[model samples]
Target: MQRKEALDILHSKLKKKNLVKHSLACEIGMKRIAEYLGEDADLWGLAGLLHDIDYEEIEDAEEHGKKGASFLKGKLDDKVVKAIERHTGYIEPKSTMDIALYALDPLTGLIIAAMLMHPSKTLAEIDTKFVLKKFKQKGFARGANREQILACEKISIPLDDFVNIVLKAMQEINEELTG
Candidate 1:
């Protein structure tokens, strides 16, 4: 399916505002990583955007990602499907983009949570130091899934480094989403 069509489907299917924001965050984060790595930004963005396409379908949250992958098979590239599948912790990624997507999926939630607590409640006002501090605090956004956020290290980049990359990327386009 075309990226636009997939995105439409995503918008229509995902009703929760938090889930939609998380999807957008992952898309922006993955696109930035792709730009930095000289990979296909659109492909990365599409993968990130559709990663949890079937998240609300499966009864077991644990299998949602994997099921989403299977559902996306033949509709998207194998790599894209794989990235979606592993976003939920069911599998390991084999490429830089996949690894970045996996690492970014949850990290963006934590970053957003941190940004929301700020006086401005905007990504433009968030800083790496603040995100890092929140990342270390287990009490903050307890469901942010630190383990998945730490998975960015699979590509040899530290958690803070990945956070900085995603945060900076989001800040650059904060107006697009926040406005």
Candidate 2:
């Protein structure tokens, strides 16, 4: 399916505005990472955009990616479905997209939390240095998994460069993200 159709499904299921924004951020993150790694940006971005599609609908957290994967089996590429399933830690990450999603997902949350804490309260105000500092504070953005984000190393992307790429990609979507 195309992005418009994927977005339609996302909007229909996710009532919370923040979740939609999060998905959008993930889309940007996936695309940016793919570009950096010379992967298929469209396919990876689709996986990121739909990774949490079942979050609001699934009662059990364990079923999050599985449900979304099942729903998307016929619609999306098998690789995309697998990436979505792997994203929630429902399964071990096996592909490049899977590993990237597992890491990038929580980093997006961390970035947003950092933006909210910034004096300017804008994506533009947050830089890699500032984010790295916030990242070191365990109490800040506790939901963001430092360990998972560090998984970028498995794909040969250092934490600093990974964060920089994702952050820049997010900056491009500032309005939709902060809205």
Candidate 3:
């Protein structure tokens, strides 16, 4: 499906404004990471954008990724659907796409938290170094798992490069994300 079609589906399911923006951030980050890794950007992006489609509808907290996967099973590529399921660590990320989503999930949160804390409060104003400092702070963006963010290194993508690519992707869509 096209991005617009996916956005329509995403919007239909998600109620929170911030959650939608988070999905957008994930889409951009997923696409950029796919490009960086010479992977299929479209499928990876759809996975990222829809990974949290079950967020607001989750009955059981543990059903997060499972619900999303079930919802998306036949709608998208199986690989993308599986990546969405594996992203939450419900199943360990095995594919490059799965690992990227696993790592990219919290990484976007980290970047968003870093942007919010920036003096200028803009993604453009914060680099990976600034975000790295925040990563070391135990109390900062407590929901953004530092260990998962570090999973970039597991896939042979250096942590710094992952941060840089994701940060730049968010910056490119700063207005959409910040507004």
Candidate 4:
């Protein structure tokens, strides 16, 4: 499906503004990471955009990805659905795109949490160092799985570089995220 159609479906499924912003943030991260890895940005962005499409409707956190994939079965590419399925860690990521969505899924939340803690409460004020420090702190954004964020290194992206890439991507869409 087209980006517009995917977004329409996302809006239809998710009523929480925060969840939508988080998906948008993930979309930005996925797109930038795809460009960095010389992959298809649009496809990666779509996977990230709809990764958590069923978050509100699914009561089980472990089932979110699977159910979302089922919800998007024919409307999106099979690869996109598979990537979304793998994002929940229910299955191992087999493709570079899948690895990216897996790695980015939680890092976006950690970065956003770090940005909120910043004195400026803006992406511009946060950096890789701050985010890394937060990453090491188990208490900070406990919901953002550090193990998942560390998965970026498996794809050959160092933690610092991964943090920087995601940070820049999210920064570009700061207005939309924070608004």
Best by TM-score: 2
| Cα lDDT listed for each candidate | 0.81, 0.93, 0.92, 0.90
For all predictions, the C-alpha RMSD in Å is: 1.8, 0.8, 0.9, 1.0
Tens digits of per-residue lDDT for model 2 on 86-158? 8977689888999999999999999999988999999988999999999999999999999999999999999
Query: Residues 31-134, candidate 4, lDDT per residue (tens digit)?
Result: 99989989889988999999998898888777879999998888888999999998978888888778889989999989988988999998878889999999
Q: Name the 10 consecutive residues with the lowest summed lDDT in model 1.
A: 86-95
Which residue pairs clash within candidate 4? none
Which regions of candidate 2 fall more than 4 Å away from where they truly are?
A: none
Ranking of predictions according to TM-score = 2, 3, 4, 1
lDDT of 3: 0.92
Model 1, residue 150: distance off in Å is 2.0
Q: What TM-score, over all chains together, does every model reach?
A: 0.89, 0.98, 0.97, 0.96
lDDT of 1 at 26: 80
| Cα lDDT of model 3 by residue, 1-179, tens digit | 88899999999999999999999999999999999999989888999899999999888877889988998878889999999889988689899999999999999998988888999988878998998899899999999988998888988999889999999999999999998
Q: Which prediction has more favorable lDDT, 1 or 2?
A: 2
lDDT of 1: 0.81
Superposed model 4: Cα runs more than 4 Å off: none
Off by over 4 Å in 3: none
- Model 1 TM-score, 2 decimals: 0.89
lDDT agreement of model 2 with the native: 0.93
